[model samples]
Target: MSTDAKTFLLTGGRAPCTLELARLLYHAGHRVIVAESLRHHLCRFSRAVARNVHVPPPRQDPDGFLSSLAEIVNQEKVNVLIPTCEEVFTLARGSGRFPDHCRVWVEPIERLTPLHNKWTFIQEAGELGLQTPMTWMAASHSKLTEILRNINGKFPIILKPVYSRFAAEVYLLRHPAQPCPALSVSPEKPWIVQEWIDGRQICTYSLAFEGKLIAHCAYRTTFTAGKGSSILFTPIEHPQLLKHVEEWMASKKYTGQFSFDWIETAEGKLYPIECNPRATSGIHCFGESDRLDQAFARPETASLILPQAGVQRMLSLAMWSYGLFSVRSFSQWRNWIKSLLAAQDVVFRWRDPLPFICQFLLLIYFWKQSRRHQISMLEASTYDIEWNGEY
Candidate 1:
């Protein structure tokens, strides 16, 4: 389907992935409107966006946030609202506020809430016969102790909030040395404790139409920490991994774009880690496959071949090397020097430079501000700066 007549609204446009997605949509002939909360960054980085609207950050006034979004949808006649972050939750819950003329792509709240909860996800996936890590949900000291006693094996278990918007309160428990660190106090809220799987981190990005997988690509994480999606290396299709993904989607009747993180154990068995119902950082790897058009299309399509192993490996290495040089432990001056060199490296090497350049400048600004205690890591993660249509 041609996107010529379509107007797309991208939420969380400040995210590097969202910016790249907007650029792709624009190149494909869709008029793009970027909805962001930070005016300064948006004004500087989002010049290519056909329109920009500054809304309250999602963390504050989530209920009132949709009013501004609805205004944009009305003005632009947006056909599709693609959310790139937790901001999606506000839009999804406020879907009723959207004009009847517009279509918002999101999973139903029933499915979405369950999927977002790690404990619920594990239970549901297990019931569906999908391979998932052993999981327990605990909300109090008694429950936590029970879970600890039950696990006979490892030391470093994983503790995560059942309904975390982002990767907040995620801990790697090395042992029962202490309590689970009270992720939340409310008795109504529970966290998931699961056996940590040791293996290679692999991911699949796919579009499913009516429970049928149309397009798919898989990649391996080259660098990742508590914060997600640092870098990844694309790989050719793995039939086994594809099989598991197809089964899970079919069972759940999932539609739209979804990504799954899996671990390949020593026995060569693939165990599901977590599932993200929206577009993920691994979507960048799809560029290697050339199947990105299928993702843009409404319905499912074909599997695209990614870059050869050599190219993906090289790119992964380049990014890692750059990270090492650019990210220092304590030497602030050296970090800045290395970052400048890294920026030059990326500029000369990136296929598309404009978005990368915008992102680079924003990074430098935030890095400087971070050192001054202007923005915490959590705040930085939610940045939504606006650039006033200036390139």
Candidate 2:
């Protein structure tokens, strides 16, 4: 470990991504303090966390969140503020408020808004000479009808909000006669109507600093919690795709962590689908403490790769329990058992036992919110928690 250790303030405590980052920073000899909106969260219980502070939710109370965070930065002498979830929207929106010494590890709100908005992202990608699907933006049902008539693609169009996470409220339409729920798009918020492309899903997590790709890891999601969240991650090499990402980031002069959802057609054409301007679960695939240290700060020494080929990192609890009840089969059961025995659960570290024990509290919280909101268990966990700048 280096003698000059930095103090990091990580936000988004309820996310497993935060726990993974805490472990990485702590092992690299940095003081890992966590600030969270929720009272009970996995990252708060982690032994890696040097301190835990509570704050008002960024989406619900932006001013309060900023004040609380400013106090924490000054008191802790935080060297950096890293947001691990959608709350990055709020943080980026108030980027100028943080203390001079504390660097907020995200792009400016101006850059983030387009990338966070799906409709805007597609347009921006196309303008940048990147491959993007034909997408139409709609602010109302009437506008959607207009787009439908002019669209050049076949049936099975994909519709989703311009800003959302975890694939919430995404819809696939097979025909005009199919019952479609009314979209919530308006002048304030918009929706995306895209040509549904058939291809393999490829996801990448990259850490960029001042337009340079310092470190990155690409992987295929072996299993997913829903249409969006990956439960199991298996890392792979995609040199061309990575190069494309590098050039794209350099062109935009992008900074901070970015996770991209992409589609690769059968002919090997890569089309960027959407961008999440925050950390994702792919960090778990890079398990080395020293490598993470270099990836974030010591970029000169960093060489990023999967810990090993064919290795699996998973949220075992979600995969096992959800797999057993949702879709029971001998093959799936065996795979789940194998994942439990062979793969590393991002939340469960034997050295940090309390967080593993306390994780169940989140499930209970999700369950209560799910019923209260009349949503699915997955949506309940993230619906209110993830602020897409919608409100």
Candidate 3:
């Protein structure tokens, strides 16, 4: 390893995007360490990860989590702390406790809080002159009914937790007879009901330093695990979408990884649906390019650039297992096969095959967690892992 190379401590090991980030950093000669809430995640077996430490879920024990991270940073001389999920909020809140030498890759709490909350984000974006969906907050079932009764909108109202990850528990109400099911929502965990806009779904994952955009990649989610997690990523571009994101990031001086779900109407208008103040699947769209390397090493100096086109990184195993059954046509199956043949597995590397094989074990872990939490596989994947600090 180069003496000039830096050390990064990455969190949220359960996520493929997070593991991909670690691979990029490690291949660039930087030390990569991971902090995972689960004991048997794929990151635990990655060759790129120098160390993997199990920690308490930040949502349940924020103080203990922060303490563990601080100890690791000081002991290992970690140069940067990178959070790859909603846990970013917890780290950002307690970032002061880390040593001055260890740079936490996140925006300050004052700026981050609003972006993390769905209702607050939409309101703030509207105030900033950005186009946003009509959103209302509902802390209980009664409040949700009241919002539904008041809004004179058409069918397919979108409802989701105000502070959520992976589109978990997101519902589309099409008929009046359908009841609003508040699965995990409470007074502490409110839900947002927004007027569903019909359009093409586009998602962007970006990194910024200070206020300037450093690296940006946008992709369309062609296939998804139900309405939740995206299973396939195809590179795409839209000048208007890029412009809107640049403006939003510049306005907030966003200083870390951020993603936004956008809907482009038929009339060529853009409305931001919601924002994820963390890395998303779009990160996998970028291969290890020089532009991206420069951004990771010294973002303050790197010029803004798009990711290069290579073999698209995908979760072929998952797509083959569960996603194949939903394929509606022969052309779709053929395209999937072609993509699978041309692409590399997201978690598998020839040099590090254990992590790829170990990823299957995560299914077992997810099953147990789902049973314990009484949520679906999608929800269990990020339930305790993501911090919901809305209260």
lDDT of 3: 0.82
Question: What tens-digit string does per-residue lDDT give for candidate 1 at 51-118?
Answer: 87788876566656788888889988888887776666566567788887776766665666666567
Model 2 C-alpha RMSD to native: 2.3
Q: List CA RMSD, all candidates.
A: 6.6, 2.3, 2.0
Colliding residue pairs in candidate 1: 38-384, 38-385, 38-386, 42-385, 42-386, 42-387, 43-386, 43-387, 43-388, 44-387
Which lDDT tens digits does candidate 3 get at residues 1-391?
A: 7876999999999888888888889888899999988899888888889999999888888889989999999989998888988788888888899888887888767778788888898987898797777788988778878888877555678888887766777898886667877466578989998888989888898898877888888877666777756777766877787888788788877798888888888998888877887888888888866435568668778898787765476787778865687678999888778777776678778887888878889988898889997898877887765767642
What are the lDDT figures for the candidates, one per model? 0.64, 0.81, 0.82
Per-residue alpha-carbon lDDT of candidate 2 for residues 83-181, written as tens digits (9 for 90 to 100): 988778888878899978887888878888888889888888898888888888898878988887765446678999887777878999887666667
TM-score on alpha carbons, each prediction: 0.78, 0.93, 0.93
Flag regions of model 2 displaced more than 4 Å.
298-308, 324-340, 383-385
**What lDDT is reached at residue 339 by model 1?**
37
Distance (Å) between predicted and true CA of 358, model 2? 1.3
Count residue pairs with overlapping backbones in model 1.
Answer: 10
